[model samples]
Target: MKAIQISQFGSNDVLTYTELVKPQLNPGEVLVKNRAAGVNPIDWKTCSGGGAAPFIGDLPFIPGWEFAGTIEAVADDVEEFKQGDEVFGFIRFPERAGCFAEYIAAPADQISLRPDGLSAEAAAGLGLAGLTAWQALFDKGNLQASQQVVILAGAGGVGHLAVQLAKWMGARVVATASTENHEFLKELGADLVVDYKNESILDHVNNVDLVIDGVGGEVGIDALNCVKPGGTLVTLPSVTKDEVIAAGKAMKVKVEPIRAEPNCDQLDRLAGLYADRKLVLQIADTIPLEDIGKAFDASRTGKVKGKLILTL
Candidate 1:
């Protein structure tokens, strides 16, 4: 099998496409033949040696976190999936499950059946960003219907999905993006779109029920002011304890930072929403497996509007 692996953490130049052995299935795991893989900021961060996990892999580590593929084989203990089943899921993400390769072995419960009417590209793109948005808006933030919610960086990977998910839950959605993405954000159900470069997000938006911060910086900390009293603010990257405490005192709202976890059950529920036509997928581009290096460069540019996928 051919895979893009990192022998050592450095730059994008550290990643190379080379031949490697496919992962062998373990008990309670299923071997999936990759069809499509999602590229994310975390992938690059890991490749560059700037993540929370220890870099202890023997040189040449496979570095993909999410994918959509079909089952090639299954462990005897796996009862829910069988050979030849089409599935998609976030595979042991952040820690790496080698989704960049042609095949991966992951726990059966971690993979869900792909929704009908969705392509492998869309399904592959849905895992990390989709789950991050879902968990932040619905799980951690406890957002409710008929409330106003502001999403920072609303045109990026998680922001685009958060905007749509908040709308699907009946919330009034306001998204922050550049002028070029106003129409795109609006289509994703952003009732109001602010150009982050030209306008102050808080100038026209205020008293929000929840704020999902996809871009964590000084601006993200300041975004806490937009939340209503007793409302919640969920930060995607990381919010310092001091930031959370200050937000609580100044705004009278709860401020929380969240890291997404892989939940197969949640993936199943999300799949059901897709099956019912409630959720939407926005893909920026799809590259073949052999062209993963180019895809990585595009994702690093931070100008891509939606998810970037690598088709196997």
Candidate 2:
């Protein structure tokens, strides 16, 4: 099988495309012949010795966690799927799942059947971002119908999906993006779009029931001002500053830092939304497996409006 492996953590140059032995399945696992893989910030961040790097044990590590593929084989304990089933999901997150390859041995419960009419690239892009948005809004923030919710970085991978999901839940959606992306977000069912570059998000929006902050740092802390008293602020990134926590406490707002996990149930729900055209998966670019280095370069630009995918 062909795979991209990093022998050392550094720049994109370290991601080497080479042949490797096919992975063997364990109990409750399935061997998938991957068609596409989602490129996330965590992929490059881990390569640069930041996000999830410490969880990777071996030197030559595969850095992808989300994929869409067909099941080639299944373990003895797996009965939910069979050979030739099309599937997609976030693999073992916060651990090595080896998704950026032609093949991946993933736990069967971590994936769900691919929705009808959804393409492999689109399915691959839906896993992490979709799950993150769904969990943040429904599970953490407890966003409800008719509630006003503000989503930061509305044009981003998670933000774009968050807007649609929030809208699907009947929440009034407000989003922050550049002026150029305001219309794009509005089309995704956002009730209001605030241009973060020229305007202040807090100035344009207030008394929100929930704030989903995909952008961390000072921006995330400042988002608390948009939330109403007793409302929740869900930060997608794993790392949150102490000041942000303190500020949320003082404001009587719930501050929750969320790390998206592998959940087949949530993926199934997202698939249904995609099939119904309620959720749209945006792909900024799709690179071949061998050109993963270029894909990483594009992801680091922080200018991509949607998810980047690696097509095998």
Candidate 3:
């Protein structure tokens, strides 16, 4: 099968589209004929030798985390799916990654049926971002109805979905995005969209029950000020563990770092939400595997209205 692998980590130019033998399945794994692959910032970060995982591979390494595809075969122990089943999931991250290829052997436990009525492109967009948003809101934040939640980077891959899920949970959603996404976010059930560029988000929001922080930087620290006392602050790509702990303790706040895990049950629930029109996964653009570099660059602009997908 044709796969994009990096012989060395440096820049996007290092990602080479080359031919390699098709991977075979092991126990508890399934061979998927990938239909679409999701391009994440982590993929680029890993390619640039800046990710959390140690560079273990000699040269060529496949870098992709999630995919939506059809099952070509399954291991003996697999009982939940069969050949030809349409599925989607986040493959093991920062360890074994091959979703950028046309075929991959992934653990069956990680796979889930794609959201009903969603095309491969849409399903591909949901794997990481959807899980992060859903888990943060329900699993970590414990958000409830009548709560007020603020979603930083509201139009981003995870932020957009978080805004919708928080709204579905009956929370009043306040979001921050560029002026361009004001209407887009409002349509996604965000009750309030603040322009982070021109206005002061701190001036507009206070006593928020939960703050979902995707843009983790100095801004993440500032986000704590918006949350109500006892409110939880959830962040991805957190800078320092000790700093977060000390800040949370000083402010009498709860701070949680989010690293999204593969959960078929949560994916299934999100699928149902998509089928019911209660949620939507927006795709910013779809690129072929050959153009993976462009996709990676696009994701870092901090202006994407949605997720970027790579068509296998």
Error of 2 at 311 (Å): 0.3
**After TM-score superposition, what is the CA distance of residue 277 in candidate 3 from its true location, in Å?**
0.7
Best by TM-score: 2
Clashing pairs in 1: none
The residue-by-residue lDDT of candidate 2 on 225-308, one tens digit each, is 888888989887655545677779887888988878888889989999899889998889899989988888888877679899
Give the range where candidate 3 is weakest over 10 consecutive residues by summed lDDT.
51-60
If candidate 3 were superposed on the true structure by all CA atoms, what would the RMSD be? 1.7
For 1-312, candidate 3 gives per-residue lDDT tens digits of: 888998777887898998888887788988899999888777787788866336445556888888999999999989988999999998673344568999989889988987459889989889888999999998999999999999989999999999999999999999999998999999999999999888867999898899998777667778888888889988776345457656777888898988788999898888889999999988999999888889988986867889999997
Higher-lDDT candidate among 1 and 2?
2
lDDT score of model 3? 0.86
Deviation in Å, model 2, residue 249 alpha carbon: 2.7
- Give candidate 1's whole-model lDDT: 0.82
Give the candidate number with the greatest lDDT.
2
Please give the lDDT score for candidate 2: 0.88
Model 1, 60: alpha-carbon shift in Å? Answer: 3.4
At residue 121, candidate 2 shows an lDDT of 96
